[model samples]
Target: MAEQASPEAKYQLGTPENKQFLDEQRESLMAFGHRFPSPGGSSYWLGDDGTPWTDRNRETWITCRMTHVYSLGVLVGHPGAAELVDAGLKGLRGELHDDANGGWYPAVTPTGDYTPDKQAYAHAFVLLAASSATLIGRPGAQELLDDAEEIFLKYFWDAHEGLSVDTWNTEFTELDPYRGLNANMHSVEAFLAVADVTGDEGWRDRAGRIIAHVTKWASENEWRIPEHFTSDWKPALEFNRDKPDDQFKPYGATPGHGIEWARLITQYALSAKIDEAEKQRLVDIAEHLFARAVADGWNADGAPGIVYTTDWEGKPVVHDRMHWTLAEAINTSSTLARVTGKDVYLNWYSTFLQYLDANVIDHKNGSWFHQLDCENKLMTTVWPGKSDLYHATQSMMIPLRDPSLSISVATKEG
Candidate 1:
């Protein structure tokens, strides 16, 4: 757990120096990700110095993230952001899409091999990208959103359970029995963006349903939400136990996700037209989730950063610190502070900002380092090069904006 520190002048969330730091970081991220687009419009994985890692496959999810980021860029008046968003939309509507099969492929290899499977994860990002681009009035974004919504409702979303399915085959004929919270978490994010941009209140209600199920599960499991699940949605606590460091699906509780969920839940609670009592209850749940994540993950290994994963009993599993986890922590803490008027969360926000400045941020290079070991030295075992600018870019901007709306909508309104 973090020892609360007094807020300093520069690290406080709304201070002039803090705003200047965020602006500079946002600009750097925009420049760093400028070279992400390939000829076909799919995103190229960026290396340490912001060069495109041409040998790696171009992933649809990465492209969607870049699309969403640049859309925010357009909202914030970044130059050439519209062109970048159009490039991402071109990829989404063209080469990466399965024209015949109807949904998106996970990735396209440099040699032109298409990775199979229609993933809920990738589709969720597609929806997010489309929703954000639509907000910025990008061409073809509404059509992309319509198609993404239809495909998600047809294949990924399980309306009966108020939850979503994990994956389907390329032809959309067979469904994978594996269920996961990771996709659903992002779906909550996408759903909120859809609701905000399209004025579809149903999407917000659907997101609330998913949140209800998650909060119940987390409450029963001592606030550590389970990640993997069986076909029937039973918690498969031992799914990846043998290989705990598997990139996407790890073995146990992911504290980063807990923190991320807290922020999303708060957003939903604030945005929904619910009664005051209900809103307070949801905010309480968000606070608990944030506290649990910070207590279990932050400095759990006698180190300064949040661990990537933890056991069911809240013990540290993977000691590596992911950049995205810290990003979510900073966003959630700032969000909690704003909604609750609590100085403790502000203290945590200051602490995270200080840690980010001192260690995680690549001061020489444009973007932050993707991973660090227990000793705070750079490590590439889990996340090699910086994949995309989605998380890092939002981390810099989210704290300065309102928490009730999605990042895209918040950027527009703020």
Candidate 2:
């Protein structure tokens, strides 16, 4: 990733420098855009404890944020973002496909050591990444996408149930493994993205089934879709307790649950093919998530982002106060407002954006800081200077308004 270069003499841009930067960097960026994903799976050799990220773990956050960037960057198409955009696209090409297994591996370090963890959820990321790369007409990225499709359909695709699973062992020894709504929804997203590009009806048809399954779960259950489950779609609450919030049963309300639950509306709003009543149901669900998040998770003084998790009592227990959640809220609420032509959603989003712009954006760093403490301070006690180019990259996942305007460039020192 470009972040490897470190903060060099504060190479920066903003309103005043717009013309100058577009003149200088635009040609360079547009010249070789969509090269690869950033921080491109380099070996950090340090653990989350700050010792070492091990060769394999380095790809985790980097890949995670790439998924975010690919989702949002296609339309944003901001001037300076093209560099990281190129890196992110190229990174996907680097960390994919192996003859040993039918599909791709997790990631590859800069030195070219391959890690063994291959998750379909991650491949789902490629559905978006490859689509973005293809949209931008990045060279040889089609091959990367082809490999992604091969592995994903080969390993994760379940024809009978019609959904992608969470992970697949490279050897193809285990099939029908753990399943979750997270991976399934993401797969639907990727599948639809490919459909949009290829005009492929099979992809959309399959995505429809996945969506139907999701909505089916909502109808039969108490809208508390279980996380992981047995082959027959049984509830897997055992792992739920180990999460930050013990017993994060997803029914009435949970921290960030509403925001997350509503994300499907944004993803499929264009093609759910729902009648007015069903569409209203989707809108109602999105609004419900916003309300629960506001009522349970909002910190009166801290502003209006959701918490990490919530309880049946409608209480929020936050472990990490993340910027991305707020970003998603913006995209979701804004999307709902736009699609439904409702002014209230826009009003909520406006206030949320103002709070974030005024308080959270790190002016000196040239991007948004990762998270804030409950006391409404930067979470320096945890990881100092942990700001990432991809945190901002990830924020752009939903295609924001005037991405250039929202982005903060390091001010050039006189």
Q: Give the TM-score of candidate 2.
A: 0.72
Clashing pairs for model 1 are none
Off by over 4 Å in 2: 1-56, 60-90, 109-112, 216-225, 238-240, 245-254, 272-274, 300-304, 380-414
Per-residue alpha-carbon lDDT of model 1 for 31-126, expressed as tens digits?
Answer: 889999999999999999899999999999999999999999999999989999999999999999999989999999999889999999999999
Best-fitting candidate, scored by TM-score: 1
Cα-based lDDT for every prediction:
0.94, 0.52
Residue 107 of model 2 has an lDDT of 64
TM-score of each: 0.99, 0.72
Deviation (Å) of 136 in candidate 1: 0.8
